[model samples]
Target: MSIMLKEMKAGDQGRVQGFAAGGQAYRRKLLAMGLTPGVEFLVVRVAPMGDPVEVRVRGTSVSLRKDEAATLNVERMP
Candidate 1:
């Protein structure tokens, strides 16, 4: 099953499943940031206010806002 990125906790692992809402430019930007489907990532951290959450992907870390991440679908991994 797929879950929203905003629902994931730190140390969680998952694969990019798909996006929920985004225009062409937004989609392209996320793709450019390496958030394409099938890519695997690990939740690294969540800010105190929970606005931006960090994930480790492609050997680097990327931080995304909760609203943006809420549009993301991720299949959790064991």
Candidate 2:
């Protein structure tokens, strides 16, 4: 069960599965920010309107816009 990263709510835990259809440059940008495949991350917070989502990965918090997050595929942890 993979879902878009933007669909995850605050406190959700998941691992990066891959990415949705998008540009390679965009994907590479995310990879450089530590969102590579198989990386486990926790959703730290979501804005009231859900524009910016904060996730903790590799011991650091990264904020992503909704559009940016939508390109990521993640599988929630049990």
Assess each prediction's global lDDT (C-alpha) against the native.
0.88, 0.92
**lDDT score at residue 70, model 2, on the 0-100 scale:** 86
Write down the worst ten-residue block by lDDT for model 1. Answer: 21-30
Q: Over the stretch 1-78, how does candidate 1's per-residue lDDT look in tens digits?
A: 999988888999999999886645457667889999999999999888887999999998999987778778899999
Give the runs in model 2 whose Cα sits over 4 Å from its true position: none
- Candidate 2 lDDT over residue span 1-78, tens digit each: 999988889989999999888646578889999999999999999999998999999999999988879889999997
* Error in Å for residue 77 of model 1: 0.5
TM-score of 2: 0.94
> What ranges in model 1 sit over 4 Å off?
22-25
RMSD of candidate 2 to the truth, in angstroms, is 0.9
